[model samples]
Target chain A: MKKKFQNSKTETVVYFICSLVGLLIVWQLAVSFTSLQKVMPSPFVVLGFIGQSLTQKIGGKILPLHILASLKRVFVGYFLACIIGIPLGILMGCSKTGKAIVKPIFELLRPIPGLAWIPLAILWFGIGETSKYFIICVSAIVSIILNAYAGASQVDQTLVGAARMLGAKPAQIFLYITLPASVPQIFAGLQVGLSSSWMAVIAAEMIRANEGAGWIITTGMESGNTVQILAGMISIGLVGLLLASLLRLIERGLCSWNIQGR
Target chain B: MSKVEVNHLTKSFGSLKVLDDISFQVNDGDFLCIVGPTGCGKTTFLNSLVKLYDIDDGEILINGEEVDLNKHSIAYIMQEYSTMSWLTVKENIQFGMKVRKFSKEKLNRKTEEVLKMVGLEKFADYYPEQLSASMLQRVSIARAFAVEPDLLLMDEPYGQLDLELRFRLEDELIRIWQETKTTIVFITHNIEEAVYMSQRIMVLTNKPTKVKEDFVNPLPLPRNVTEEKFIEMRNKVTNLIKWW
Candidate 1:
């Protein structure tokens, strides 16, 4: 089993490198054969643009503006979701009344894409950062609530019975047995929610924004700069990848003793 | 004083009656084993005493007081592996003591004492999954003892072990019983084990189960299982349990 795991790790690393090389080859071919380079630009062209920008300052600003803007949007929306979703998920999982009340509302609203919420969000929170924040918040909250609920409810009933028989009270049982048991599941939900919100609501930002990576793309496209557009796209993908990796690390850290190996 | 008394006890599941008018007594410091065939309500009776299941009829008393079944402190070690999976052997053992609001110094001392008693002092850091089935059983036994419980209820505690490990655990149990002198009401399907462990054996009939036979074990302590008297007593109880 240990050898299998090591071999798989090596395979994945090699696969990632091969895929990057493959994409570069395709981009080079596209630049030579088609109009895609005129629109999307070649990978080398975009890398050259970013390299030039590394030394030259643009309007007394550097790369951090776009990076910081995107980071702030993610943190604000994600933090709000965490504060509201976790406890609510636990309650809904444990109580019939809570599930009965919350399930209907979630089902009705959950299917609507985050981008679709832009019109109402603009109306409600105005054409500001709040609208983008609302989009990400909506995108993440349902998964957190659902996963947390499932985790808390899925606790071993026998353990609850055993604890109660051992003289633990209702509150004590929840604190000692149920809550601790549900943690692995809760982490799973948070990972899913975090990654989804990171990737999904960035599209909402593209619809209308003065800042953010999504806005960076729109600005480059309007200015007819393919290299800048490609850089913006790459920025989005890189940030999403970094955030996803961070979440995976957190999941492993928090759920080290979880029953499932993953 | 009789630490436990079951009076005219009756319990049924739906239309099927599991126990019928069962009664027994265990004196303080006595090791009483209740043995019968499979599905003779041995577990149901034990569960009823702990009030894990609501009784259909009758009452159980602990030392002349009607056991406020909800309020009494009883340690129950089930046959199946149900120890908290995340907790280490030491933490599992200390659970009851923590629940009972024992002081940290007292909890530490009792944990150390019980870990030594189960010969699991070295395995205290192991999780339930890391330990063997017999070792897990020992942790369960240790948890039950850590509480310094007045009434200890065990349901086939050694039923999951290999023959050699089973005998070793039986001897371990006897050692703990002697040291703590806690009143134990053990339920098992093994008649030989019943004879080997108890001062009194209650043989239960098929459900709606009732006490079919009761025998006092007159054999001496540290009794040899290979002795002629031990074999004769085991055969007698085994015959009493046999049915078509």
Candidate 2:
């Protein structure tokens, strides 16, 4: 059993490496064999650009600094969404009046994507940090609210009844039963919300930013530097993977009892 | 005394009356099992006692006062396992005591005691999903017992368990009752189980439900299901509400 487990772990790393090597091989072959090489850089060129960007400036800052700048916007906006959306969603879910008052307004805004709000966000907040933050918040808050509302509203009635029978008061029931029961779902919301925040940051940065991965891509386009754009894309993908893994680790710690967490 | 009194209890869902003026009383520490035909509103009767449903006419009193869930210390085990899925076996057992604001020392003691009683000490950290059906039912029972309730209501708590596990849990339940002397009102469709577990058996008729028989169980403790006297009592109760 131990051997089998160890084998699967090693197999996962091996498979990941094989897929990346396969993709690189195909890219290199395409560059060598096709005229499309004029439009796109070879795999080696992009890799070299990424390595160079680690130490040298791309637009005005190094690649890591650019990635950090984008991450900061996501943190601020996503944190705001969590604080505001979670409580609002729970209130809407738990109270009939709250649902009636807030649900219609939320539904109206929900269908409009966060990227779609870029123009209005710029108009409202004047292309500043506030507008960018607003876009990320708008993108992320919907999923947060939806998941929190689902978690709170769909709590098992039997558990509530059991709590009441055990002499829990209204407030005690909410705190001990309702809140804990809703946690796994709240984490689910946060996961989606985090990804949304990340995406919104990229879109926001693309429009107007002096230092961010998105700025690297847009400026690369202006200067016709495919290597810079590919490097920026690669960094975004890596950072997104890291952020998601971190959230999953936090979820496992918070909701260890949850089946999904395990 | 932890007596439960139901007087003139009547409940209706729209036009269909499920329970009609049903009334009974259970004395302190009495193990009274309520048996009825399938779909004869047995669960609705239990729900009425818990005030989960509003009865059109009746009063359910615990020790001479109207049933106030918050004030009264009562533990109920429903047909479903009702073990909180998010909680471990230990936490599920402690759930009631924690809700009642038992002191930390008391909570720890009660949780340990009940976990041992249910034979789930080793599985204390195991989630409900990891447990078997019988184990889940045991967890529910342990949770109810941990509360040290004045009144315990169970609605076919072992309904999903197989016959052997059901018999085992029934015996375990009797042992707990004998030790604690907590007033228990158990509801079941199994006449044999009712005969095996109760000091008295109350039979209900088809809906609108009413008491068909309320009499003492003549069988002795540590009841042998195959014993002639036990079979006789079980058959008598079976005949009382046999829909088939």
Q: Pick the candidate with the highest lDDT.
A: 2
Report the lDDT of model 2 for residue B152: 91
* Span of ten consecutive residues with least summed lDDT in model 2 chain A: A253-262
In candidate 1, the residue pairs with backbone N, CA or C atoms under 3 Å apart (3 or more residues apart, or in different chains) clash, namely none
What is the C-alpha lDDT profile of model 1 across A89-120, one tens digit per residue?
A: 99988988998998788789878866677788
**What is the per-residue lDDT of model 2 for residues B1-244, given as tens digits with 9 covering 90 to 100?**
3899999999999999999998889999999999988888988988889888889998999999999998888999988767888789998888888777899999999888888876789999999988999899889888888888889999988888777767767888898889889899999887878888999999899998999989998777888989999988877987898866
TM for candidate 2 is 0.94
TM-score of each: 0.86, 0.94
- Looking at candidate 2 chain B, the ten consecutive residues that score lowest on lDDT are B160-169
lDDT at residue A67 of model 1 (Cα atoms): 62
Stretches of candidate 2 exceeding 4 Å from the true structure: A1-12, B162-165
What are the chain A TM-scores for all the models, listed individually? Answer: 0.85, 0.91
Q: Which 10-residue span in candidate 1 chain A carries the lowest summed lDDT?
A: A55-64
Q: Over 4 Å off in model 1, which ranges?
A: A1-41, A46-63, A218-230, A259-262, B8-15, B64-70
